[model samples]
Target chain A: MGLLAYGDTGWGDELFFATLMTIAVALVAIFIGFFLAAIFASFKLSSIRILNLFGSFYTTVFRGVPELLVIYLFFFGSSGAVMYVAKIFGYDGYIEVNAFFTGALSIGIISGAYSTEVFRGAVQSINKGQFEASKVLGLKKKVYYYKIIIPQMLRLALPNISNVWQITLKDTSLISVTGLVEIMRQSYIAAGSTRDPLFFYSFAAVLYLFLTFLSMKLFNNLEKHYSRGY
Target chain B: MELMIESFPRLLNATILTIELTLLSLFFGIFVGAFFAVLRTSKIKIFQVISYYYSYIFRGTPLLVQIFIIYFGLGQVEWLRESFLWVVFKEPYSCAIIAFTLNTGAYTSEIFRSAFETIQKGLIEAADGLGLNKLHIFFKIKLPLAIKQSLPAYGNEMILMLKGTSLASTVTLLDLTGVAKHIISTTFKPVEVFIVAGSIYLLMTFIIHNFIKILEKKLDYSK
Candidate 1:
């Protein structure tokens, strides 16, 4: 409809850009989750009791709490901590937590908890003999991980990673509470200003479904590509 | 820590609301989910198709969008406003319940369907051999076995639903997260307020987690 047209009067361009922002935030969070997941998964897999406890504790706290609370902590709560540190450094001013940073970080932490479980499961599923054979071949630790272990872990973890991606993508909607101009926020704004909630929300729903469908196809292809040999 | 104790009552009050919302919606979700699960696996093509699309649309989108559509979108319709449905959709609490019920129902239906499928064909055949009616067989055998088999997965779903109820706060419902945000706004102490609130949620979920573990063990023992 004309209401969704491009340029200033219409919200078409705004919606398109919001969709991109959603994808951008999700990708950033997903990458952050992958890094955190690696560390936590290692801690979980470690022999040390303290390390295992820390890993379990991290996942339990993050996974058990509501995602909204997590976001609120990062958005509103972090500013207090940030200000205290800034005051210590003698650069005290009203420091604000940016929407993108808060949104991505909170979701990233939540996603990392799930990713930790997924990666741990993948590591546990790998054959111990593979590690033994790699050592027998005189492969260094780095090469063992990269050449022998990482690929297999990736193949096994791909399906779960895809699930995490879907979760991360959908969770981006919650970031709208922080005033991020993502798809949900944009639709909300347009709906309010135009007084057409039904139209704008349906449009937003369609956009989300489109994103989900595309991601599903992409992950399916990745699964096929990674699982080529087995 | 001191602030957390002082604010405990407020947080506990909100926790009660959160628990109420979760239990009520989950109560509705289970029945709707079960019905849809049956429909999904039924011989009727139309029922299966309806079930398929219901799950597809609800599962594909985020609960936030669904909430918005129901609250903001549906609330806009003049006919809906004039109809008897207005009683349910007019208030934020009921709207939240409806959204949570439908969303959880979609996910739970899938869980139930998988659980039903896992019910061995031989058990159903044996029940049939005993000359049990379809309804009797489903009620006596398939339903119990499917639920028992699905208990662990259903526990995860319950946790998810508990967390999902936080979304109600966005719609102006004063649940746990909603109350926490309110306290933070008034007290200007986001960290303390949120810590208290988050801990309450963590505690509740921990209890549920352990409860489910005990249930799983008991079920395993009896089997």
Candidate 2:
């Protein structure tokens, strides 16, 4: 098969599928990360000292360590942990967390640490007077967040969070070590199977470039919308 | 505890590899990054656009992806396989250094570019009024000031690079995290190994933070 030929004769098919998995993992991780970050950010913002300390510990430990270490940590025991939880639910059969969930969870958690910082910074940037103003107007917390804080926070946090999202996308490739069939893993597999590491790997790199290009466009548009002149 | 005692030498050995990769790549990356920063802000639109696009692709993408594409991507082609560059590309260590250097370069260049713009116009005018040429002003005044201004950002970047060095494990380089993973595979203690590795990284990060802080103080004293 020719180097660039499709129809499973070359690296083309594998590279394309890998690209899809990469995007899928990135989306999954980012969503989970955003949710977890919001929780931690709120926790950090709360009045309780212990809760704030816990938040501090969470960010310190995760953010301080390397992403690869986190991945290896989770990958080694994630399946066992999942199975243990499953056993409590009256399911005895083996319930393993395959590479996808393992990768997603690790990246999601790592990205969450970063997202927490971004979110905390954004929320903090808003003047306390605004909240005070909202309270004077008899606005509920939920209503205030929805109508005022969330919108403004999005504007403040969009660039930083978008950058974290990009970090998440790239970190997904690290899970190839866990034997995940994501883009990088797929490329690695094709490289080994075809003994043509250079071509397949280069093709996968292009897929990443494509995704990065797409997301940059999204962030720029979002920035424009939140921009003062616009 | 006993296991750690036995593993200390091995772990220490791996630490050397980790440090070598981190320091070498960072030094080289900063050089490349500074170059790109100049290119990015140069008057020529093509230079500006090219540097911008380079940063766009690199900074926008994850380091792991870039590493993978380079490591596996280069191996996929027959032509590259035939090329002399295969000697270096075939090795995991060389490929990792290349990847880390390129990725850090993209980010640090952005730091430089921002710091460059932040140099006060008045500062430039004052230097000009002193009869200093562009080259003299840049080297004697601008560069030093930019370094001081950008140190905190570079501090963060250094810690990131420190952590990012762990990614070299994926390429089979057996750095700290790689050794951790290896130890866990044998000892069946994932959490312990990770905790140990994590602490080491934290120590490294703290060292970098202190180093940058010291540099700032020194720069302050000089002024």
Candidate 3:
């Protein structure tokens, strides 16, 4: 009863804010994922065999490893990376990389691998004749890409994109390790401090479920919008 | 450096435990995943729906959160502590194994479900036309094909699960990552220790990926 209450003794406010943080991290990850995957997808679809192999290898290596290890690597090695970059620019003071950035990057790279797969499938599904016709119509490749290929890819890629979105949302919970004051970390502290595991965890689970439920609804509507004619 | 050399045996022991945990959990996870795949693909709507939602919840969340819920969350309860089940829950190693397996099972089931559904209907029809019964058709034709189709996805899942075993360190299971953490805390050098740890993981992942490549080639699945 004390655990569930809305007072200071309870975790009502902390849980709410933490859930918000989860959503924030998730959104960041998804946006980054979309951008990275789109580039990789295009590279893979390119006619050059070397480019295709590079894209394939990138996805294969990233997807084959665990997300946890990626996070750990970035988490531990980021300082050195930042210092190296700083030295290149002649700003050699101890500049620290934010843990949030590290966590988001790790999750983004991981999710991007899957999104690359989705986007590649979508890109391949676009009729080859359409691209040829655009070229024959004297539309420049850049204009043709923006005006045609990207839009159709979005439509074809919507459902899978939504699935990736949901995964990214849940994966934000892993930010607990990065010392981010996200929902999982907040609930972890409150639970350990209060010794009310069931109450706090149940709260955390509900928060995750709520975020995912909203995501499913959002994606469902997006999918519906894309699927209107069909 | 001497301390690190001294801790080599302990780290080696922990490495063995970590490997055992990952492989064992993977074994159980694959079993559970197979069952769920069967259920999801079955003609029964209820089973399909139930498995779908279950996998949804598990796959939607991080394994770290899941392990936290199982190890710390469940262990904090008074009743659970006193209950017969506490025997399993009391050990961080056991709890980590259970959590990792359950989480991996959900993801693997999705891979399998996709693989299963993609099995060509024409092939099944051909098998039937050849006088193959359901069991014979499934055992001789469909199952092998589905497994072959799933090998790439399954290989990725295996590596993901292997990487996930590193998170067990948080719950006090001193696997490779755990050893790195302990070393870093002692030497105050996260970079060096994590480099060693990350290299270890990277090496293992590359090895597994090659093995999967070989197996995929052996399967010779053009489709």
Candidate 4:
């Protein structure tokens, strides 16, 4: 218990901030995933063969590969690729890629693959009659999508989006291997220093469980709110 | 390209280890999953709550954290280290298996619980009317029906576990990804090593996807 005390004596402050860092990274990753999901979902839903093939390939590769490998790829590749581009521009200095950026991007890509499926499913679940009705009323395609299609898609995708968020949040733990001071890494350091591996790791587990429980409640409320008329 | 070609044999051998880890954990996971699933759906409140929390806690945390908890954290336990159980936890391979089994068991229990819950009331009532005892009803009717209902989701879980086992490398177990990481560290070719490793994973998942599809069709009693 004394080891958990705040301030200089304990790791309480570090762990607290690390938990926040985990949430921040997860939020950024999920934000990136939303845009990627939109693009990939549209590509998948489009009738164009090449775009459909590209979309499916992206999803399959990301979904199939281990997330740790994906993180490692980004961690190792991003710096070299950036340095190469820098050299092409006549600057040969090493440009370090930020761990936060790589972490979020890798997790974002993986979550994007999942959320693409969710978004695609949501759009497909939209009743054909909705499209027919908008056309029957002579609405513009833009207006139809803005008013009818997107709203329904968001509503239908909310549950699965929550699922993707949970995964994204957990995936942040893998990013700790890249030296990010998130909950996992923070706990790892604390445990090693204190020689109380069980205490710190259990503490980390509790923090994760707490985040998950809170988000579950939040998502449940969001679902209820969105389902008001339905 | 040449580096990938050169490392292919070692990677292939490691892929065998990866497959071994996935199958062994999943084999044990199924039993643990089934037990918890039954407890979750049982009439007793205590059993139901116990299974609920077991799955809840395990499923809520990341598998890496779970691995660390078992492999590193548990080693700090003085009594457990002195106990005979430490022999199992002493090795990274077994620790990874234990972590993966519990993690997959939590997920599988949820899948099974839903499957069990969806068993039609009439079917169960018919079994009851036929004078089948509780154990008989479970083994004869509930288990088979739940397996059928849960197969698709269980297939997805299998694929997930396949990917998840790659984490064993973090604990120093030389699974497929572990071998790739080793090669990368020595050759300094992360791109080539990962590409080869990633392709192997994709090939494995493709096989699993098709295999599950075939299994689903075979198990479709309606056909």
Candidate 5:
């Protein structure tokens, strides 16, 4: 119990802070992923064959590879890429791509792949008549998208989005490998330093379950709100 | 590129280990999952609750945490170290198999449970009326139908397990990801090494995905 005491003597404070960081990274990655998914979904839905091919290829590659490898590639490769660009501009000292960026970018790319699938299904499910009616009304593409398509797309996609959110949240643990001080990493540090592996890990597991439970409830509520009219 | 060529042999061996780990754990997971699925779908309330909590806890948390708990948490227990269970639990390799098996078992059981539920009651009643033994009915009718119904989802599970095997690298197993990390550290060529590693995984998954699709098509009697 003393091991879980607050402040420097224990890991209570660090674990709490790390839990917050986990949530932060997951939120940022999810937003980045959701944004990219919109583009990918649109590509899949586009009239051009090449765009559809590109979209499928992106999802296939990301979905096939392990998330850990993706994190490693981003963590290790980002610096070299950054340095090459820096040299081209004649500006170089040391540009470390922080673990946060690496973690978020890699998982964001992964989450984007899955979200693309979900979004494509959601977009395809929307009534074609809605689009035709909007076109007949002489509504601009932007207006129709915002007024009709976006709202309905989101309502339909909420269930899947919530599923992806859980996946993203759980995936934040992989970020621990990149040396980010997230919940998993913090617990590892405390466990290693204190030589109390069981307690710390069990604590970390509980923390994760707690986080998952809370997010599930939150998503369920959002799902209810979106499903109100239907 | 030259360094990657030199490392190909080593990477191939690592890939073999990853495949072995995935398949071995998958074998155990399937059996365990099937048993739990029976429990979950059984008439006994206690069995259902036990199966429910097993799947719930395993599925709710991340696999990484589960791996850590098994590897680190179990190691801390002195009684476990002294027990015969240590033969399996003491080694990182065995610990990993146990973790992956249990984790996949939970997910697979849910898949199996749903697949079982989808089997029409009429089919079972017809089998019962034919005077077939329960064992024969389960083997000829229930199992085949459930498996055919569950193949697509099980294919997804296979891919997940393939990806999940990479986590074994965290426990110091020389699986593909672990070997990739090692080569990256020694060669200072993370980009090329990881790209190769990632491509190998992509190829394997692609093969399995297509293979599963072929099997699904072959089993599609309705079509």
Candidate 6:
């Protein structure tokens, strides 16, 4: 307990801040994931052969590879690319790609592959009659999608989106390898310094469990809210 | 390009270790999962509670943290270190297997539990009416139906386990990803090494996908 106190004598403050960092990174990554998912889902739903192939390729590659490898790729690959671009601009100094951006981006790419499946499923589950009814009503394509498709897709996808959220949150722990001082990394530091690996690691697990429990409750409420009148 | 070619055989060799890790843990995970899934559906209140919390804790946290806890945290316990169990906990490989087994077992339990729950009541009642004992009914009827129903989900779990085994590298196991990381450290070429390694993983995933599809077809009685 004293070991977790909130100052120099304890790692509580660091751990708390790291939890917040974990949430922040996960939130950013989920939005990026959702954005990429929309594009990929649309690509899969499109009639164009190349677009469909590209979408499948993206999901297959991302889903098959390990998330750790993806993070490592971004961590190593991003800095080199950044430095090369900087050098071209006559800035020869080392350009560091911060771990937060690398972590969020890598996780975003991985989660995007998953969310694409969810979104595609949601889109496919939309009855053909709805599309036919919209056509008969003479609504513009934009208005049809906005009023008829997107809202229903959101309702259908909410459960799985919550699942993706859980995975994204857990995946943030992997970002600790990129030197982000998230909960896992902070706990590692504390465990190393305190020579109490059991205590600190258990503390980290409890923090993760707390976050997941809270989000599960929140998602349950969201699902209930979205399912209203349906 | 040269580095990728040069590291390809080494990465391929390390992939054997990766396969071994995934298969071994999954083998043990199935039994653990089955036992817990039974407990989850059992009538006893305590058994259900125990199964629920076990899966809840394991599924809630990241596998990396679980690995750290088992590999590093457990080694810190004084009594356990003094005891014979130290032999298992002291080795990073065994620690990783234990961690992966428990982690996958929790997930597998949930899958199996739902599969078991969805087993048609009529089948069990028919078995009961046929004068089979409780054990016989469960082993012969409920288990087979659940296994058939759960095959697709379990196939996804297999791929997830394959991907999950990459984390064994963090525990000092020289798996495919570990060897790739080692190569990248020395040669300073992450893209090529990872591309090769990732391709191997993708190939394995493709193989698993087809294998499961074949199994699903073979098991489909209606077909």
Off by over 4 Å in 5: none
Model 4 residue pairs with clashes: none
Clash totals, every prediction: 0, 13, 0, 0, 0, 0
Q: What is the per-residue lDDT of model 6 for residues A1-230, given as tens digits with 9 covering 90 to 100?
A: 99999999999999999999999999999999999999999999999999999999999999999998888888888888888898899999887898899999999999999999999999999999999999999999999999999888888999999999999999999999878999999999999999999999999999999999999999999888878897
- TM per candidate comes to 0.97, 0.91, 0.83, 0.97, 0.97, 0.98
Better of 1 and 3 by DockQ: 1
The residue-by-residue lDDT of candidate 4 on B86-175, one tens digit each, is 999899999999999999999999999999889999999999999999999989898888889999999999999999998999899999
* RMSD per model, one decimal: 1.5, 2.8, 3.9, 1.3, 1.5, 1.2
For model 2 chain B, the run of ten residues with the poorest summed lDDT:
B2-11
Task: Please compute DockQ, using alpha carbons, for every candidate against the native two-chain complex.
Answer: 0.79, 0.62, 0.42, 0.81, 0.80, 0.83
Docking category of candidate 6? high
Model 2's CAPRI class is medium
lDDT of 5 by residue, A119-200 (tens): 9999899999999999999999999999889888888899889889888989999999989999999999998999998899
Tens-place lDDT per residue, model 4, A10-68, is 99999999999999999999989989989999999999999999999999999999998
Question: Which stretches of model 2 miss by more than 4 angstroms?
Answer: A1-7, A10-13, A83-95, A228-230, B1-9, B68-87, B221-223
Which candidate ranks first by DockQ, i.e. highest?
Answer: 6
Better of 2 and 5 by DockQ: 5
Per-candidate interface C-alpha RMSD? 1.0, 2.0, 2.7, 0.9, 1.0, 0.7
Clashing pairs in 5: none
Task: Name the 10 consecutive residues with the lowest summed lDDT in model 1 chain B.
Answer: B214-223
lDDT of 1 by residue, A3-32 (tens): 989998799999999999999999999899
Question: Global lDDT of each model?
Answer: 0.92, 0.85, 0.81, 0.93, 0.92, 0.94
Worst 10 residues of 6 chain B by lDDT: B181-190
Q: Worst lDDT window (10 residues) for model 3 chain A? A: A61-70
